[model samples]
Target: MDETRQRIQLVRLLYVSRAVGPQTTAVTDSILSVAQSANRQRGITGVLCQGQGLYLQVLEGERGVINALYNRITQDRRHQDVQLLLLEEISQRRYADWAMAHVLLADDDPMVQLHHPEFDPYSAPGASVLKMVADLVAKGERIRKTSV
Candidate 1:
C-alpha cells in the first residue's frame, strides 16, 4: 500500500468549556506553549478560540490520539462543563498547518459585542460555532500571510 493509504485513521473533535476562573494573557500564553509542543509531538493539530469566559477548540488527529487527549482535557481542573460537540473521521485536517493555533477574542470584538450579543459559546449550536471558528481561522491566516 502507498504511504498515504496506509496512514492511521484521522478524526476531528470540537469541544467547548467554561474557564474555572479568569483567564489572563499570561495564563493563556503558557497554556498555548505547552499545548503546542505536546500536540506536535503527538501528531495533533487544532485551533483554540476564547471569548466570554469560554473556550471553543477544534482538534484533528488520529482517532486514538484525539480520544486520549480529550480524556485528559475532561479531567483538567481548569475547565468546567466541558462538552464534546463534534467528533468524526475526516479525510483531511482543517487546521493541518497549526499544531495549536490560539485566538483570544477581546471583549469588544464584534463577534462578542455586536452580532452575537450575549454570545455564549458553550450554549451555542455546535455547527454554528464550528463555522465561526473556521471563519476566524481563515481570517487570521490571511492576516498572517499578508504580514509575512
Candidate 2:
C-alpha cells in the first residue's frame, strides 16, 4: 500500500434516468434549474455533468446537507444507478460562489473516460474526474476551460 496515498474531496452524485440526448443544450438547462435550487437550499457549490444518459454531480457543503441531498436524489425519477464517488468534508467549500453550474462532457475528453470505472463506477478516472470537476466548479472555470 502507498503509505502516502491520499486524495481528499467533497461530493454528491446520482445517475440520470431520462438521459439527455446527444444535443444537451435543453437538458443542461433543465438540470441547471434543479441544481440552482438545490445549491441555494443547501448552500452548496458544485457542478452537474449530463451525458451518455447520466447525471454526474459533485457538490460540496455541510456533511448533513450533502447527505440529505443524496437521499433525495436517489428518489428522483430523473436519476438511476446512483453511486457516490467521494463524500468527505473539506477545510473549505469548493463551490462557494456558484448557485449552480453545468457542463456537457464531450465524448472524447480525457474526463469522459471516467464514466465507467474498473467496474464499480467508483474507481480511478471517475474519482479523479469528480475531484477535477469539483475544483473546476469552485474555481468558476468550467466554461472558460471548455471554450474553443
Candidate 3:
C-alpha cells in the first residue's frame, strides 16, 4: 500500500437535513457552487438529493475533512435538524466522480420512482435510502455512457 493511502482515512457520512430556505433553482445553484468548490479542495465527493423540503447528502472524504465539513453544515443556517444517518470508514469512494452531484427529486425524475407516497427517509431505514442512491447513480451512469 502507498504511504499516502495508508495515512488517509476515508469516510462516508450520510445525513438528512431540512431546508430552511426555498428549494428553488437559484438557491440550490448557489449552494451547489459553494459546496463544489470547498469539497474539491478537500478531496471530497458526494451527492445531494433534495425532496419534500428535505436534503439527504452523502459525503465521502478523509475522516478529518468529512468531520470538519459536517460540523460546518450543522452550523449552517440553511439546514435545520441535521441528523446523521450513517458514518463509517470506507476503502474507496462510491461517488468519486462527483465533487458534489446535485439530484433534485422531482416528480418526473427517474429517482422519484424510488420515492413513493408512503416512502420517507426520515422515518424509514437508512439503508433503504443508501440503496436508492446507489441504484440512481448506477442508472445515471449507464445513461450518460450510452448518450455519449
Candidate whose lDDT is highest: 1
**Which residue pairs in candidate 2 collide?**
none
Q: Rank by lDDT, descending?
A: 1, 3, 2
Which residues of candidate 1, in runs, are more than 4 Å off? 1-7, 141-148
RMSD in order of candidates: 3.7, 8.4, 4.2
Tens digit of lDDT per residue, candidate 1, span 55-95? 88899999999999999999999889999988888999888
Taking the tens digit of each residue's C-alpha lDDT, what string does model 2 give over 1-148? 6553453445444333335244357656766776687678667776676555656677676666778877888776556566666665577755566665676555554444553332223444555756656543444433422110
Q: Write the residue-wise lDDT of candidate 3 on 1-148 in tens digits.
A: 8787778899999999999978988888788888888888889899888766888899999999999999999999999989888888899988888888876666666565544455567776777778776766666632221010
Highest TM-score among the candidates is held by which one?
1
TM-score of each: 0.85, 0.65, 0.84
Instruction: Sum up the clashes in candidate 1.
Output: 0
Which of the two, 1 or 2, has more lDDT?
A: 1
lDDT value, residue 131 of candidate 3: 76
